[model samples]
Target: MKDSDSPRRRWWHVDPGGALGGLLLAVLSATPSLLPRAALFQGLITAVAFAVGYGVGTAAWLGIRRLVPMRSRPILWIAYGVLWLVAVGALSVLAVAWQNEVRRAVEMPPLDAVDLAGFLLGFLPVVVILIAVGKLNRRVFRALQRMSGTPVALLGTLTALIAGIAATVLVVMFGVDAVYKGLNGAPDAEAVEPSSEFRSAGAGSAIRWEDLGRHGSAFIGGGPTASEITALTGVEAKDPIRVYAGLESAETPEARAQLVVDELERTGAFDRSVLVVATTTGSGWLEAQTVDAIEYLHAGDTAIAAMQYAYTPSWVSFLFDPDAPVESARALFDAVEERWSRLPADDRPELIVYGLSLGAHGGQAVFDGLGDLRSRADGAMFVGSPNGSALWRTLQGARDPGSPVWQPVLADGREVRWISRAGDESLLPGPWSEPRVLYLQHATDPVTWLTPELIWSPPEWLDPSQRADDVSPEMRWIPVVTAVQVGIDMLGGEAVPARHGHNFGDVVTTGWREVAGDAGLDQAAVDRIQEEIEGYAPIQPYLE
Candidate 1:
């Protein structure tokens, strides 16, 4: 072949093999993930998948070229291009059908013509821009290599790469730190003095209202009132004790935990029938469903204590200050456990632990393992736990042979029971044990499934035979594409309707009842409390 016609001579242009690979993977990216994705998000996933596939294909082609001459007739190349286009069109149609199947499974509206247009419009520009950027970076690296002498070319390239990475890291670090500080320092509109002495930071409380921060104030102010609980349960109820220590409440985690214990004592929480150590999400947000359900179930004779560790949202904390939740949860639990342990075992109120999402991950960190968790608290309820939690992973891995990963049955459900919906507890066999640990996880919740391993391997939840009923049967796992799609799914996981994705909703009432082993709560009472909780508006709306 002439030099102009040689494949090596056209290295600057988009290689046919790479483009073909990119198209194939990009099309496959449209397949259903853990949750139904928005058109724009799907487009982004497709663009990312294309970039990854193109890189892999380019490398493979380069390797093959070294072993054999890359030569093809003009007609053969044209025919291959035509076949690729046909494949793309065929796969695109399948992609739409698969997405609609996922939507139907989740009770979401099907994708229409506008969605298709949106996906195409979103995908084309992003993919083209990413390709352009990749080419520009490659050209810049090549130019740098050429400028250096042949003897020092490798060293020059290494130095440039290191410098570029270091500069990027520094910029990101400074930018993130600035954003964190701004958020942490901003004044909360809801942090006002409470009129009732029953609440933390209220009339007679030592903790200041201004120190409660946004989420802390909301948590302290929210939940069913004594009258509301009495009306719903038809039994006179005591005012539920809610104690919180915000980030500004004390300087350190230890101090904050101690303050919470003090506030709990001041509110006579220990005298209540149930005392709960409720771990807060990154912004110190507590799920109303979890706490309210337990309170109403016990006829408002409950005390719930929580503390803030980070000012940012859970995702931000997961990325930047991953250890914050764990540390805070450990401190608060240890303090409460110590204080509760000192009281007369026969007279002391039942100690329970509760958390949702990142809060669940944090709450699990308080114990060494399953044995420790069982021994420490009377019962524990962790909702939408992230896959990274060690205790959760251990229990899940130790699940009985026949159980599914989405709703694992641990040890015949003697101690640990995984609840996906309202009546999942009924599916458990054998006698129920004290200190029951319940994990409330939806099959389609990406937060509970997304992990780094997803980039290379399929999770047990994707096993064909053991898949949960809520997950679409058509959903197939594709290595890197699956990881990206699921990660994106986490962004809007909680926005979906209750019982799907990360929104556990009122199903938590069942989880609380099972974990608490409240025999007094019949189906009617549970339904009433759930209904009341569902209708009640939150003092502050915060995402899990």
Candidate 2:
């Protein structure tokens, strides 16, 4: 057999062109992203970027080889190896510097020697394993191709590629389905029974406490008491009513929504000065701050109704069961609206819709247009709305030309407005209209901006002219790499400080006051409310 055909030589072969491409992207992957990433996450991003880069480089090289046949030399390989080592070593140091820059910008701790050690520990094995897998797959395909003449060989390779992809897709689908089922059925270890008289199923008329899933129970039982609010605001307050229905409470969305409405009716929720229809995240989790803010702003003269849609977290529900939120939000809103509309317009509570993250996506799905929105609800506040939201996209696409994409001015903020931080609502110099729709989205929020388009084209937010205040200036868009980085960023989006990433934090107080109409809150009162809510610890998701 010839040297090229030798098994040992084939097994050991490394493509110089591919290595160069991988190195280029691996270095670029270390640049600043939408959020600050730790050593482990950075390593994962680098490895994945390297793998993708290697594929692109390999494909390009193959195309070149087809056009002009050339053989590699030993001396050239030696020189290339030395150059590769120098480039990698130098770029790695730069990568660490870039990471530190991001950390400083985000007010996070700088990476140390231990972090570098951790990065290496996380990166090497993953890259090696990925390369090995790719080589093995290629070897199998080549072996099949070699079994017959040219025409048959081509057909065999095509057949193998199709079969492999189909098998992979099927395996992934089944595995993911099983995982979802397991998660849905799993009991929450942190779940505790409700003791609050104001909460659903807590010494109440109908819904059982046990039937309220972990998040459902937490939503109903948590938040400030009327006395707590009164103390903070220096005003008398009534107990805030919270009604929720878990997945186990009813089988279908319609049933659960009906149950929610029934609970609201029994609790005299419609009689309250302010009523909020809160669409919950995937695990039926409501942002404690979002609900608490409205209750405080209304001096506990508020009732919030929500229901569970899926058992998984927001991200999982986003990818797997995207329709659950849409379906559940529509059902709950329609049911509540039906009942509320039947009551005397002068006597009933002012209706408002609220949602965050996946909840926002679902809540926005309920409205067909601005007309539909104004016709149904008094006002709407959607925080960290996902890019996939059609209503959000429509409003944003038609935003005033001069306004930045991060926080667009829709119709000069006459009806719809977007805010990243407090006081943004007043930034737009236009007449404020009734039935206001406010989008509370941080400029750095991956949940609000990350999309498949990012894999190919640069988003307008990444443009220097349109970049947000919180986002690092060093952040640049790279095809595929930026997409992966931002996708990973979503995992820890809410872990950062308020007004950054996906964490809306205490800004919801201002947001609630703006959308729901401030009862009598002055700037001082709003500040006190923010301080009060800030003291409350974030509720941990039971499934998480």
Please give, for residues 1-544, the per-residue lDDT of candidate 1 as tens digits. Answer: 8975554664447766678778778877877787787787677778877887787777686666565444745666788779887988887788789889988888889999999887888788887787777767776766777887585777967887999899999899668656754654333565455667678888778888777766777777777788988888877788889998888888999999999999888889999888999888877788777788888898888889999887776887788889999999999999999999999989998999988889999999989998999988999999999999999888888888988889888778888888888777788658978988888989999889999999999888989877987789988878887887887788888766777888877588788777775537667777788887666553332344
The per-model lDDT (C-alpha) reads 0.81, 0.82
The number of residue pairs in model 1 that clash at the backbone is 0
lDDT of 2: 0.82
Per-residue lDDT, model 1, residue 533, is 69
Q: What pairs collide in candidate 1? A: none
Report the Cα lDDT for candidate 1: 0.81
Model 2, 1-544: lDDT tens per residue?
Answer: 9986677776666667778888888988887888887688678878887887787787787766555434645566688889999999887888887888777766678889999988887788888888777788788767777875598778867887799899998898668656754655333456555665667887664788767766777777677888898888877899999998888888899999999898888888989999899899887888877888888888899999999888777887777778999999999999999999999989999999998889999998998987899889999999999998999999999999989998898777889888888777678677878988889988888888899999999999988889876788888888887887888888888766676777777478878877886668677887898987777764332232
Measured with C-alpha atoms, the lDDT of residue 92 in candidate 2 is 83
For each of the candidates, give the backbone clash count: 0, 0
Q: Model 2: what TM-score? A: 0.89
Those runs of model 2 whose alpha carbons end farther than 4 Å from true positions after fitting are 1-14, 55-72, 142-167, 177-187, 428-430, 518-525, 535-544
